[model samples]
Structure formats: C-alpha cells, structure tokens
Target: MSDDAPVKADLDEIRGLLSVMPKADEAARDAARAREGQLTKPPGALGRLETLAEWVATWQGRTPPRIERPRVAVFAGNHGVAYKGVSAYPIAVTAQMVANFQAGGAAVNQLCAANDAELRVYEMALDHPTADFTDGPAMTEEECATAMAYGMMAVEEGIDILCLGEMGIGNSTSAAALAHALFGGKAQDWTGPGTGVTGSTMELKIQVVDEAVTRHLPEMTDSFDALRRLGGHELAAIAGAILAARVGRVPVILDGYACTAAASILYRADPHALDHCIVGHLSAEPSHRRLCEAIGKQPLLDFGMRLGEGSGAAVALGIVKSAVACHSGMATFAEAGVSDKD
Candidate 1:
C-alpha cells in the first residue's frame, strides 16, 4: 500500500470523529451552577470564575472538572512565504526555535514547567518549507491531511487538557491569508507584525498576504482547501489536534493568533469544536481579537500576550486549575453551616 493510503485513512477517521463530537453536557453544567449557588460565598460573588467552573464542568461532562495531565503540543514548521521576507525573522529561526523547545530552553518550556504541564514539540519539516501560497498551494491535499493526522496522534492517553501552539516564521502571513479567506476580509485587516516587524517590512508582509489571498481566494472552497492552499504544516496539525481533543472529550486551551487561526479551521469545520476550547489569552497581534470573536471565545487572560509556543495557554492553565480547585474544594452552605440569604 502507498504511504498516502494510511494518511488518507487517518484523515477519514478524523472526519468521522468530528461528526460525532458530543455536545457539552448541559446536565453537568446545571449541577455545577447549583453547587456554586450552594457554596458559602455570596451569590454571584465569585463572578466569572463561577461561570468558568461551570463551563469546564459542562465540557468535561462532569460536575467537578479536573485538569489532570495537561499537555501542550507545539507544532513547528517552515513556510515558503518566509523567503519573501514577510517576517522579521529568517526561516532558519523556525528550526532553531524547535531546537530550543526540545532543549527545554524556550519560554514555553519554562512556562510548561511552571504550570506542571508536559511539553511536546513536533518538528514538521521546518527544513523543507511549504510552497509559497502566492504562487501555488502551500501543500498537497494529501500532505496537509497527513500533517493533520500527525497532530491528531499527539493526544495520548490520560491527557485531560490539551494546549495548542505553533512555531513557524512567516506563519503570520499564512495566518493572514487564512483569515482573509475564512472571514472574507481585507488582507490588511488580518495582517500583523509578527516578531516585531514594522514600517516597510510590515508593508511587505501585508502585500504578501494580499497576493496570497488573491491567488488562492478563487479556489478556497472550504476550510480544508484554505488550509491546503495557505496554511503551514504546523497550523494544519494544530487543527487536527483540536479535533482529536474534542473527540476525546478533552478540553482544549488555545494560544495566540497563529494557534487560533489553526483552531478557527476546526471551528469552521465543526462549530461544536469550540465547545471544548478555552481561549488562553488575547494576543497583542492586531487580528487576534477578531479571530477570538470569530470563534466566539472570550480569552481567559488579556495580558497582551503574543508569544506563541503555548506560553499564554500554559500560563492560563493556572487559572483553569484554580477554577477546578474552587469547584471541587469549596464548601457548600450545608457543609459549612452558613446561613442562607433571605
């Protein structure tokens, strides 16, 4: 059998899995809300945290959600568009950052360590970047599907929460193209300074995005087509990971713009996919807020974070853990013998 056969099979399996993503358990959410009402705290005193607890419970299909064995998978790939000088950094930085991730020296490594989350980095051929989308499709459909299958395979047993991250120079350009295609927006609206490019470099990035979007817009019939035409391997893999986590009933924490762009593909593919996702933070990237709005996710943090590699998601894990702890450990009025409000 050809190697592509397995990948095609895997992609088929992913489609089946996406079709069956169970809705969040409204019963569990109701139970959590009831328990929160009964907690010793004043009604609505805990505010959004209370809602967060219930949200987690609903998605987890349980009353007291536990964020156990949190895992952050950072997918790294190279973009052919990087050769166009669309980004401040060179394409070589993609491989170098992947090495940094593996070496446990990157910011994500430190953040994952601090959050007690396991970090896995996938080097999806940064050495051989995808074809420049301005000229043609970024990858063959089979190759894109294979990359996504690799992402779906990242979800191991016992992982309760999955965080998505990406490392690809010029990925912002790819992401801009994706946003333009998916949202039917101007390229400038989705374009941003990735890694601190400004002035003429930023203009070049926008121009590149416009060129790619215009070239691919006619053929961008669906999310998969958009991905194949304009997405980095890392982005496609992240979409696969999101779909896998949803099917596995594992909640997902999304990172910044690039990561969200990947998740947006999954969201567009299956609206139910966002039912299992938590926006980790709002990125400083100008287009990130729009992506969050497009996905209907309010970020858990808003510290202007733009660093990828799941740094924001790793940081937000603390908030999730605290919310879970509150849900599980807080005493109810009956347990605490507290007087009920009149």
Candidate 2:
C-alpha cells in the first residue's frame, strides 16, 4: 500500500470526528446563565466572566464547569521561508527556543508554572525545513496529515482545557499566507512584523507572502490544501489538536496570531471546530485582531501580548480557572441571603 493511503485514512478519520463533534449544550448554558442571575453579584456585574462561565458550562455539558486539568502544547517547526528574510530572527532560533522551552527557561515555561498548567513541546524536524511555499507547497499532503494526527493524539492523554502554541521563525509569514488565502485579502492586510521586522524587512515579508499567495491561489479552494501549501508542521499540528479537543468536548484556549491562524484553518474547514475554543488574548500583531473576528472569538484578555509560545494562553488559564471557580463555588442569592432584583 502506498504511504499516502494511511495518511488519507487518518485525515478521513479526523473529518469523520469533526462531522460528529457535538455542539455546546444550550440547555447547560442557559442553566449556568440562570444561576449567574442567582449569584450574590448583581446581574451582569461580573461581565464577561459570567459569560465565560456559561460558555464553559455549555461546552462541558454541565451546570457547574470544572477545569481540573489544563495542558499547553507547543509545536515547533522550521520554515524554509525564513531564509527569505521575513523575520528578524534566524531559523536557528526555532531550535534554540525549543531547547529553552524544554529547559523551563522560556516565558511560556514561567507562565505555565505560575498557572499550574502542564507544558508539552514537540520539536518537529527543524533540519528538514518545510519547502518554501513561494515556490511550492510547504509539505506534502501526507506529511501535513501526519503532523496533524500527531497533534490530535497529543490531547488523548486527557485534558479539561488545552492551549495550542508554536515556535517557528518566519511562521508569521506562513500564517499570513494561510490567512490571506482563507479570508480573501491582500497579503499586506494579513502580514505583520513578526519578531519585530520592520522597514525593508517588513516590506520583503509582505512581498514574499503576496508571491506565495499568488502561486498557491489555484489550489486554495480547499482549506487543507491551503494549509499544506502555506502552513508549517506546527500550524498543522495546532489545527489537529484543536479538532481533537473539540471532539473530546474539552475547551481550547487559543494563544496569538500564529495559533489563531491555525485555528482559522480549522474554523474554515469546520465552523464547529471552534465551538469549544476560547480566545486567550488579543495579540499585538495587527492580523491577530482580524483573525479573531474571522473566527468569531472575542479574546479573554488584551494584554498586548504577541509572543507565540503559548504565553498568552498560559496566563489566561488563570482567568479560565476563575471563571470555573465562580461557576462552581460562588454562593447563590439564596445561600447568601441576598436580595435579587424584584
């Protein structure tokens, strides 16, 4: 049997899972909302926190949601496009940062430690960098499928909440290309100064994205095709992980631009894929705002974070925990002997 056969089968299985993925339980959401009204706080006083609690309940299919296990998975890959000078940092930074992640010295490590979340980093084949999409597809369809499957399997260990992150220099270029293809916009619109590229470097980055989009436009009709053409293994893995989390009915927290770009691919392929996702924060990257709007997710925090190591999501886990606490631990008006609105 050809190697492609197994890859196709795996991808088909993912499709089947997505098709059967359950929607958030509206009954549970309404129950949580009703309980919020009965909480000691005035109606709507808690603002988005109350809404977040209801969202958690709806996704968990319970009145009182619990976030017992939160996991953050960081997928690292090398992009051939980095050779085109899209990022100020060299591609070697991808591997070095992966080592830093494993060493528990990265910002994401510190944030995960502070939030009591487990961190898992997968270092994809950095030596075999993905093909530059400006010339051809970044990876074979089979390779993309395999990477995605790896991501899907990562969540099987069981998690109540999962956050997807990536570490690949010039990934923002790949992300911009994918976003441009999915959203039907000029490359400049989705392009941003990733890793602080500016002036000539930023202009070069935009040009590279435009060229890649033009080359891949013919095959951009399908979301997976666009992904394979313009996305790195890490991005593909993030999509797979998000899909898997949704299938398991575990809520996902999205980090920043690169992560959201991957989520956008899943969202475009299956709108239901994002049913269990909560945007962790708004990234400083300009395209991130548009990406969130495209996916219909309002970020939980807006701390101007643009780091791509799941730092935003790691920090936001505290907010998710708080939301769960309010939902499961807050005293109702009856218990508190507080008067409700007459």
Candidate 3:
C-alpha cells in the first residue's frame, strides 16, 4: 500500500468496521408460518416454498420483504490447467460462453429474462490456453486491484440481491483445488466428474489438482495466498464480489461448484461472510453435496443439475420472491378474520 493510500493491514479491523448485526427475525418467521397455515390450505401443504418464504423474511428482517431486481453477475475466465485434458470442453468455450451470456444465448440468460432479473457479465483477465497450472486462474496483484475497482463499482449500481456464476472450461479442477486448499482434504474428497468426463479422465483431473496443491503448498501459508495461488481469475473476482456484497449488506446466492468454491474461499477469509449468503441449489457434481454440507447449507433444489451458468440460482429467484411476498404481503389470521388451526 502507498503512503497516501489507506493501509489494509488488518482484516479483523476491516471486518469489525463492516460487520452488521444479523437479525434472526424469529417474530417475522413465526408470523409468516401462522399466516401460511391460514392460507386456505392444510398445514405444510405448500411444501418447501412456504418454509422458504419464512426464511426469506428472516433473512430480510421483515414481516414482509421485497427483493427488487435481483442481479446475477457471471464471471468468465480460462483456467491454465485445461491443456492437461482434465475438462471435457476446450478453453475456447470460456470466451464462447462469455459471448453467449452477453448475447443472451445461455441458460442463465433465459432464466434471468424469464424471471426479469438483471444480469451483468465480466471478463476477468484470461489469456489463451496457457499451460501454467501452477500460477492459477487469476491475475497478478495489479490485475486484482483492477478487478476490485470494477467489482466495487458494480456494488454501487444498486443491487438488492446478488448471485455468482462462472463460465470457465477447466474451472472444475480449479474449484476442487480451492476446496481442498480451504477445507484441508484430499483432492478426491472435493473433486467430481465434471461435464461428463469419463472415469479415467476423472482420475487425471484429481491428479492434476493434487499436483497443483503439492507444488504450491510450500509457498502458501494463508487463505489469501492459497486463493491467489490456486484460484481462477473469475473465481477470485467472484470471491471479491461476494465479500463486497456481504459488507454492503446485500444477500448473495451461490450457484454450483465453482461459485460455491469461491464462497468457501471467502468464508475461510472471514467466517462471518457465510451469514449473508444463500445456497441456490445442490449440483450434480458428486463432490458438491459434501461441499454444501461443509458450509451447513442445504440447497433449495436438486434437479441433477451440473450446468453452471447460474441457472440454479436464477430458478431459485421465484422461491425467494414468493418468500418475500408472503412475508410482506400476507395478512395474519387475526387480520384476515381466520381462526388459527393450532
């Protein structure tokens, strides 16, 4: 840091300055549940959606809430480890899908349009098909500074809710590597057969992550170091955006493996970060369920989804919206002239 600049030497101090009191909103939840029971339906008839709305009320700290214009930001970058054939798709697919997202040709695009959520796409610095798996998916310090500037700018653009997505091809390997680094486990514990890779290819994928970790373990003694060493450009930026959103008091939805890995990194940096996040779905990645469990989050859906365009998060928007609506809009039994079943 320069002499003229604010020193960022203490993460604890930064957290202390930004951390807000978390409201459990128990009253709001109880009221919503009571209203749900009186909704002209049997108890628990609405399944998880009813419970989901109650949680949304608690998250928003209101008897009735509103999540106006939720924003989905998809970060796109290429991983250097793709040359090892760990992924089923080519590195070009990163840029290709980034274009698709911008052009509204991807699944996330359709879901965002259907749900009427605002979407933003950022291209974190990705070079073409580099083989330096040891370096990582992100850029140098200068690049991170630049990305932070853009991320903070996005936070200023008025987002009530946030969700993260990734479009990198070999990022599953990077995601597994980040999970192992953040969670202290074997690569096999956090890796899965991503995007239809065969069993032999999966083995190779695990070996690559193990090698990347082994090569960098000696140099990394901290969470940020491990992230800077093993995390992708988009993943690192997503981590930054997550932290930024959390500090800014906006709830963030996490997509599948790669986006979840970014959340894991942020939580390692600051455990309080998890308090502001919601898990969008349980992915088809064999390791994803375990990863979500590690964070004590049960995803709202499980459609055998392996597609990571933030589709899961996009789909969850309705549940969140309905939850907000019920919390803010529904009348209590007394107000609506109905008797409580209980």
Deviating ranges (above 4 Å) for candidate 3: 1-51, 58-63, 128-131, 135-139
TM-scores for every predicted model: 0.95, 0.95, 0.84
The TM-score between candidate 1 and the true structure equals 0.95
Per-residue accuracy of model 2 over 239-277 as CA lDDT, tens digit each: 988887877778889899999998888788887688789
Native-referenced Cα lDDT, model 1: 0.85
Please list the residue runs of candidate 1 whose C-alpha ends up more than 4 Å from where it truly belongs after superposition.
1-13
Which candidate do you rate higher for lDDT, 1 or 2?
Answer: 2
Each prediction's Cα lDDT score? 0.85, 0.86, 0.73
> In terms of TM-score, how similar is model 3 to the real structure?
0.84
Q: RMSD to the native, candidate 1?
A: 2.4
lDDT of 3 at 93: 82
lDDT of 2 at 154: 65
Clashes of each: 0, 0, 7
TM-score of 2: 0.95
Descending-lDDT candidate ranking = 2, 1, 3
Candidate 1 residue 100 Cα shift, in angstroms, is 1.4
- How far off is residue 105 in model 1, in Å? 1.2
